[model samples]
Target: MITTHPFNDDKLREECGVFGVAGAIDAAAMVALGLHALQHRGQEAAGISSFDGTTFHDHKALGLVAGNFDSEEIMRLLKGEWAIGHVRYATTGETALRNVQPLYAELASGGFAIAHNGNISNAVKLRHDLVRSGSIFQSTSDTETIIHLVATSRYRTLLDKFIDALKQVEGAYSLICLTEMGMIACRDPLGIRPLVMGRIGPEDGGTVIFASETVALDIVGAEFVRSVEPGELVVVSGGEIRSHRPFQQKASRPCIFEHVYFSRPDSIVDGSSVYTVRKAIGGQLAIESPVDVDLVIPVPDSGTPAAIGYAQQSGLPFELGIIRSHYVGRTFIQPGDGVRHLGVKLKHNANRPLVTGKKLVLIDDSIVRGTTSLKIVQMMRDAGAAEVHMRIASPPTMHSCFYGVNTPERSKLLAAQKSIEEMRQFIQADSLAFVSINGLYRALGEASREEEAPRYCDACFTGDYPTPLTDLSEREQPNQLMLLAERVGG
Candidate 1:
């Protein structure tokens, strides 16, 4: 049997999603629901670890949540009052059961399990150090690095050891941990990733919830509380929640792409509505680049919201020019060679009647490799469209993201090597325009981005990484290595 990934192949991929709850009667089930709500963030694998006051129970598998955890038998096995779960789309490690998280360990402090979202840039260096110091690693995941750090720390409390573990790492992380002590939720110093807190039940006695997005909270009937502050470590135990900032504070720079593509439309991230922000980005694109088109069409699901805003702002009719098939599986057995060439058409079909003889505007979140864009433009022409113009909601993605997102190398990025005109030619579109960097910031409610110190991580677009790329710096071209080495250390 053969398996194939879903149709759209030109989009950036998110790393993972995490959810944790403390004090819930059915903690594992609640975590399941939260993970389901965040399924879009990661589709490769799912796992949950629960602490039942006396012992830890866990189930991890390599597939969707519905297939793995929906059974009553599976839920029954994960009995506990506190739990943490993770849905993974691997960025730093291979897709295997061992790499699947809520990675658990037995430390001097008792059972510790953690589910993480985002990449640890210094993991390679740290792993090398730990291995050299006689620490044995159970999994290949960088998340396990923290576990080792905690196990070896001389600190008196588990919280202190966890804090010490975090202080030694660099890169983006929004983590939810389960321990005999309690539930610990924390974000990195720069807040490059996102973690939100919520509550359910009566005010006096409620279940504390932590998840990667507000949508997760909504799914579980939890009231959305404030985000876990940058550089803040939150410990929930004994019906009480406490916050601490162990690392030096700095300006928070959450990943801006969450607004562009990663998060669910209904999610509220970093205090902004993702749907509204995406719509605004489309509106901004329309303002900056207007073309005479008969209709505005989205590339389906991801582009729907932005396309609506573009249609509204441009005074053009909105149409479903392309219809997406929801039934396509992650892996399918191809019967013959002839059917393999119809890959894009298998997932998306042009609405011939609506697209015939129309000069259409196609709006998409971002262009990664340009292969999907090329195929879609050809599909529109095949459906008798007079012309197809492309409008991108976010600025061109020029640099690879080392902070969790899976992106092609800089040399492979479409925009990194080609000019705007070249990109239009490559995608075979009549015309193409991307939202300006400043316009994107404006849509996000900022006047303009501060070149000196950006409010968010736009490194993929501007090449201005907020944190040091430790792993990449050591392996980059020799000419550039010297400069980066000096900036980051020897």
Candidate 2:
């Protein structure tokens, strides 16, 4: 057992939510609760903005919605029939209260609200262009760049300005906007982020909601319609759903990671079960990365479903070797090495009786920086597991993600830094194997025939960004964070 915590482990989620009501009266409170259900997508900050049949009201705070929103206070201020709310995890911006979403802006045409999921890879260039034109920005986020772009457009109507604004920016984004006239939602050409249109009810027959995941829809009692097509824009107003597309439509490339790790199991994604996809990934791992072992042990939580699938497919028995303590909230994860050293142990407890002197096959979703995996492997070994064969359900994460996921530097990525044999030696695993890209897609493809329409964006694997970035005039490469910071703060 290797007892070591490797450097550069950052598990950050960039997923967010956009919930709205066009026809309902108590829209703000409803959006508040809807954002709560979608909180798993992001927990750093929460915000809600609404356009009543008359006036717009907004409130955003720098903590989880549960902590920030005092119901009576927010509800008292938020009075409206139409609303849009957001929960965010910082990916392309500084983590500050000002950077939180459902960004409210007063435009020459009228008032509008915007919430964005995914990253604007070309934001640095766009921000520079805006600044050169005397555009002043209030927040340090890629999402804010779009708002500035829209504000500067020469077009007359908000819709015209918005369409022009979409043309100027590049990269993955699913944007939901609350305009004086209606609610507008658009998915990037690549569809790196997920967005679905939801029908509220038969009673409130005309109401519709837009969200990053179907789970938000389920919570709001909205029926899952279909995903907003890549490079498409849909607007809901006057109880009527309308769409516009000044930009030409491009190939649809949805993010495959949504099924791998992000989404809630119960929420349907483009017509497939998230749980089933995970299980299939596990099943594929067993077939592709087989090993002789006494027990198949999951790393707990995300690894459990895949581990079960692996166990069932491999005809090997599965055991709850690492038990996760659900009671530990984010507050329990203390910062700094003094408490950070307890990252793995505080989250999990090893069942020594099951592993004492056993050869265990450990299943995990993927290794980010080798920190958590190294620590967990050492814990298993310390628990008396003589041999630990590490199996990863996804392929090696080599490239950094610009589509709103908080991945570290490529140099820090263990897979990019070390080969399979090198990683096995580094983690001291008896053997280490990862499921192939083909196996991952194959397993997911086999799970449902209905998901064939929209192909997934595996850019993190293949370096194939579906949308061509046009505004990275200053960005020579993705790793130039220092240069980016200088430009932003200058």
RMSD to truth, every model: 2.3, 5.8
Best prediction by TM-score: 1
Q: Summing lDDT over every window of 10 consecutive residues in candidate 1, give the lowest-scoring window.
A: 474-483
Candidate 2 Cα misplacement greater than 4 A, ranges: 1-12, 203-205, 332-339, 446-454, 469-490
CA lDDT of every candidate? 0.91, 0.80
User: Can you give the TM-score per candidate against the true fold?
Assistant: 0.96, 0.90
Minimal lDDT window, size 10, model 2 = 1-10
Error of 2 at 314 (Å): 0.6
The candidate scoring highest on lDDT is 1
Q: What would the per-residue lDDT of candidate 2 be over residues 1-490, giving only the tens digit for each residue?
A: 2222222253435557667666677888778878888887877789998887678888998667886775697787888878888998777667678898888889879989998988887898889889999999999988889999889999999998998998888888898999999999999876778889888776335678888888888888887889988888998876678877667767667788788777877777767888888889999999988999989999877788789999999999999999888765554424567866667787787899999999999988888778788888898889999899999878888766777887776677788779999998888889999888888888778433223343677656544445555543233255444434655694
Tens-digit per-residue lDDT, 215-306, candidate 1: 99999999998999999999998878899988998999999999999999999999999999999999999999999999999998899999
